[model samples]
Target: MAVQSAPEKALETVGPPSAVEEGEDARVRKKKGTLQDRQDMWRIGREQELNRNFRFLSVLGFTAVLMCTWEAVMFGSQYGLLDGGAAGMIYTYIGAIVGFSAVILSMAEMASMAPTSGGQYHWVSEFAPPSCQKFLSYITGWVCVLGWHTGIAGCSYTVANMLIGILAINYPDSYVPQGWHGTLFVMAVASVAFIFNTFLAQKLPLIEGIILIVHCFGFFAILIPLWVLAPTSPPSKVFGSIEDRGGWGNNGLACLVGLVAPIYALIGPDSAVHMAEEIKDASRVLPLGMVWTLILNGTTGFVMLITYAFCLGDIDKLLEIETGFPFIQVFLNATNSVGAATGMTVIIMILQFCAAISNVATTSRQLYAFARDNGLPFSSFLAHVNPRYTVPLNALCTSLVIVCLLSLINIGSAVAFNAIMSLGVAALLSSYIISTCCLRLKRWRGEPLPPARWSLGRWSAAVETFAILFLLVVYVFSFFPLTRRVDAETMNWSVVIFSGVVLFALSYYFLYARKVYSGPVTRVKQLM
Candidate 1:
């Protein structure tokens, strides 16, 4: 018998369960088994051992906390201001909100259709042409896996830097942050995330729910105080002023480089896609969760950017503050009390820690899925799900180890580590481009898609086209150096690092993987 394709298998599974034939064995088994037993055996067998504990609200909370838009702007706005000034910050944020909204909508539609933990790669295999499907899917899986691994390192590194920033506030005269210090802090933060992902795995949804409340309410906690205490700038200065501190000569080039900041902030909403298997009614819930995350973060992030622009005072002095982040300087200048600034910094730190934990969860799930599909070396070991916890224990451990190794880069060269962190945007956007482009091609060719619970219907073509084009443009800019004169220290290493990852993945595929890996296995019955 010929094997069914993934799309066909998806349709078969979604259809009504195959009826049990009536006979002695069937009747006795039907009588003994519950109603669920009468359902398609293939469908039941396909479900990997993961707990589908996430409801719509819980998933929304998870995605919102992962995005953490307001917090990101607070810490990452320096790059925007350095390149774009106040006007660039405002307009770039608006553009990013629109652009990323399109990107996520396209991804959400794919999630609705496939609803698998493999996310982009799985979609690529389903939609890509048969001849290139395996190769494309394999490379996409590696890119996503490495993108998320770097993302974990980036989040933990930021948290570590912030913690050191707080210490600087307390001891301005004596505090000096060393590379080793940041590395140690990264390890510390990663350890906390490991504990949560392994020991407290079941509490993730509830924890994310609580963090969502903080994500919303915490906006007021920081914003209200800043607005009340900080001296405000004029409308022109807040909305029209442009700065080119990076010596890029052309203001337009500066603005393009600055776009990376907001793009980075908007990149991880797709983190929820990796959790599809662990989400209840994932076809509908995943799309709803992703779109709502964008709306909530986009609105809050825009307001926070505006607030930052207006409250910014004495640019030179703020930039000169001993703390690594300019936002800490903003707090100090506004409050004029080290104690108050440190307190507010602590709140942001808590939220950052929560976001790091969520990153770990997402990274592990993606790794688990890819390994389950035999897309990674040591697939059996990495894909093992813990019976007791119903979590990917081995995969989580593997991610933790890789994160620890990546954090070591901070010790030798913070600049190089930063370049690695910057890979998140370029790497992820490439994956988005491939998957969305595949989707658009399939739609354009009128290939019949499996029915999707959450779909764009009439608007799907336009949205996918826009999303693919937008990502292609952004993917190019994500590699531009921040300053005109690039040196070892100032270079934007995203392109180099991203290129190296792709090269390694392709090299591995040609050397060993192509023979063993055949894209996603069609035997759903063997998944468990």
Candidate 2:
């Protein structure tokens, strides 16, 4: 008997192909019994749709901009300076990059094996025990959805506060930074992001590419001037200074609380993982994009931290500057010209705003993916994609509404808004812990996983274990209040809100979702 040619075999399996059937047959024949291959086969089978508009560089750019590492450090440095002082900030940042790298590496491996917009939840469903898969995946989805949604609010809030900071720089005594001002700015920033996501969706690749350029060179643009003109603190001051402004009593507790800033900066490298469906060769490209983005951003963030510490002149004056941003004050002092300082501040603001834009895009994709699995309140409408642009217009609008609603908390209490921001970090890390622990359990059971284009090989177990342990530490500290003393104004409400989200998800699952939701829907048939 002669072996059949590829086309002949496809025809035998799928029958004589019309134009559309012919393309489907080709994809079906290419399935190789791997998890990624199964996902592709499923997409073709179910007629699931997302245009593969991102190439490697574009995806990398998207991931890099989403991290916005140096920008985050600048925006969030106050926490570190207040709690850990210069020494604590510098050392904690280094520790965070190391710990976060482990988590990213583990996530990248799983991404290579099962690339999907469903991301952590999908991986959890695949690796979790059959008896609990539905419940586990359902809760994971909710956690991730809330995390990304709050992420949009958090990033936009940063942009909003920065804009106000700029205003305060120009207006000084007259420009009082109020809670309402931040809230209004958040609405404005989110609105712009919504317009870009809907009307200009097709241009995202180009936009991200340009933003990546700015994210990289913008570091040097700010750094060189500060280094050249700013009066430097002695090495002792930069490396050895430690303060307890948090009133935490114990210096150790203060340092632990300060870890939140750097950890939050590293949270969203997995943002690209949610765009798996939009990237060409997603299994390979997704992991590469994630790991490389971490490396690039982590390195630059560390260098930027050192520069800020060394160039930090009068700590007392910086803290008192009306800008609400220490870096802006540092820039002004370094240049000795408000004009140059404002120009540099504007550049950072642009990068931060670009980050908010990318945050909305990624968050909407996560929303669309969850809704497609019938996980949300109005799944049908929320999951609808605009055919012309192949973007989730409805989901984008829905996210905008939720973010705006959440921003309202800022008006009543900035401390409350801070809790919502903490929810983003805590919720995301919770999802990470669940998915990673599931993966580790599968490996420990000696179950076979599909071959990955990117593999950890002999180091898989060690890396996964370290990732889990490190994330557990970060998760615990994320809920700690910056100030030791508790007041309505100073209390950390993340624990309260995070617990509420979990309780609601569990209640909804038992009440309705368990009967209807069956983990991720298998839109494709098994190729074997």
Off by over 4 Å in 1: 1-45, 411-417, 521-528
True-structure Cα RMSD, model 2: 5.3
Worst 10 residues of 1 by lDDT: 32-41
Q: For residues 190-242, what per-residue lDDT tens digits would candidate 1 score against the true structure? A: 98998999888988989999889888888998999899998888998777887
In candidate 1, list every pair of residues with a backbone clash.
Answer: none
Instruction: State the C-alpha lDDT per candidate.
Output: 0.80, 0.81
- Segments of candidate 2 deviating more than 4 angstroms: 1-46, 412-417, 521-528
lDDT tens digits by residue: candidate 2, 317-373: 676665667898889889998789889988888887888888899999988888877
Q: Per-prediction TM-score, please? A: 0.91, 0.91
